[model samples]
Target: MSSIFESIEHAQAQLKELAPNQWNAFQQFNELVFKEGALSVKEKEIIAVAVTHITQCSRSTDFHTKAAKKAGASLKELVEAAFVATAIKAGGGVTHGTHVHNAKKTDASDFLYARSNLQNLKSIGKNAHEGFKGYTQFNAAATTEGMLNTKLKEIIAVAVGIATQCPYCIDVHTKKAENLGATNEELAEAIMVSSVVAAGSSFTHIAKMIQSYND
Candidate 1:
């Protein structure tokens, strides 16, 4: 009987044989995206680890966790990156509550189309809204000048938003990153980093499934 652990190698070999061109292209793209550019290779790998966690890519989590370590990211820095993703994911839900609070008097359909009515949140849920403000401040503090600067943290935020498929977050962080002097090239590279990690996650998980089935 085959072991699940051995299937990853087998699946990769089969993929390369079945679609050599596509496989090669993907490999090339991955190599290109991780190269040092607007963002350093170390910074890119740190962002990759964050995106992997947000995408919940177990395989990628393993890969990037090691890559980040190799790139000289300390364990504290890695933990901070993970928390940035956590903060954004939680904040997305909380911010959306503005729409919900505003729609209380309207029909349910109105809630679906409601934009962020933050003012309404202030009026309707003062305490909770204050808590939201506190969270926003915390998020700002977390991403500011520290082991990771604001610009890089915002780049990481944009990548996380893209991986999580949160438009609000993408808009917010992309603009914030720009304001903090992140060039278009840097932004594009950050997004590309996310794309590769997300795609890699899918391939690796499928490999895991194949391994299980063969076992």
Candidate 2:
């Protein structure tokens, strides 16, 4: 008897009709990503490559490796694209935590101290991938927003990855955004979104403090 995934693979191969739920979900999501988007076929393939990395979905990565080549992407370019994803991913972590902690304070109350504290947290987020899985869903979901035009949004996905701190998302979006034409300069610029919002979010601390005072 074959394993469940094998059965799905066989069904997927034969166009037969009996696959498992996880298998089905994967297949359905694959269809959605490929069939309906403003992105091109090669673009989607590259995104899929990144998705596999961020999701840490082994099979998805395998599929995209083949697909990217099929779509005419060079192996070296694909690797470089993935590198771009990782670099931005490293920076996004701090931006996210700083954003989170900052979003909780208001009126510059402890703004200076909080900025310092958050800087520490952001560093933790970036490196959390060494032995953690805190923010993959958060980052991966954000990475799905490939619809925007500015390179900033792409880097924002890295920031999201930082917030969530998932290596997989970091891997995928870094590459996907680049393949979508995010230059190194553009990639660097994209990360600025994290800085802007993270700093601004500190101002939200006011609302939190007010709510606490009322309580």
Candidate 3:
């Protein structure tokens, strides 16, 4: 039986063949994103690893994991990055759940995202309350300092938020990261890293497209 996932070794020639200009452009952008600046290549790769987890792209995960290891990321550091992704992903659900309360309010503004919306979580259904508490514990544990520092974890969270495209998370974690002393340059690099990896998740699947066409 053929596997759905294409190996890392699979050629992307078919994709490049179909759109050489766009593919080449993406390559250039990807190269620039990984270049050392405020964040080292290793730091960028670790962010890519976290974004892959959020995107649930095995190809990106494999690619970034190896790149991270090659850049001297320890197993512990990579795992720490992954857990940050986990916390960010779970955070989206909890933050969005506030919509349930906002939906019931007759006076609620047309605006979808607001700091006030977070208040609704306190009124979340009892059935979900315990689960929410469990998530809170896990998120705290995952985000607190371990192999990675709190500032780096928050930076990873910012990147995952962008990858996951959660406005609340982007807003919340960006602030958290800033408060934790993450610089403008650092956050900018984090966003670019997220962008490339998110695109790469789709880019890697071109192999599957090639396989399907042949079969």
Structural similarity to truth (TM-score) of each candidate: 0.83, 0.42, 0.92
Candidate 1 Cα outliers beyond 4 Å, as residue runs: 1-6, 105-134
Which numbered prediction scores highest in TM-score against the true structure?
3
When 2 and 3 are scored with TM-score, the better candidate is 3
Error of 3 at 53 (Å): 0.5
Question: What overall lDDT, based on C-alpha atoms, would model 1 receive against the true structure?
Answer: 0.80
The residue-by-residue lDDT of candidate 3 on 41-67, one tens digit each, is 999999999999988888788789999
Per-model lDDT: 0.80, 0.48, 0.89
Compare candidates 1 and 3 on lDDT and give the better one.
3
- Model 2 ranges with Cα > 4 A deviation: 1-29, 99-215
List the lowest-lDDT window of 10 residues for candidate 2.
Answer: 194-203
lDDT by residue (tens digit), candidate 2, 120-196: 45455566675334454544443343333334346545544543455544555677667777677544433332332
True lDDT of residue 160, candidate 3: 96
Candidate 1 all-Cα RMSD = 3.3
Off by over 4 Å in 3: 1-11, 125-128
Candidate 1, poorest ten consecutive residues by summed lDDT:
107-116
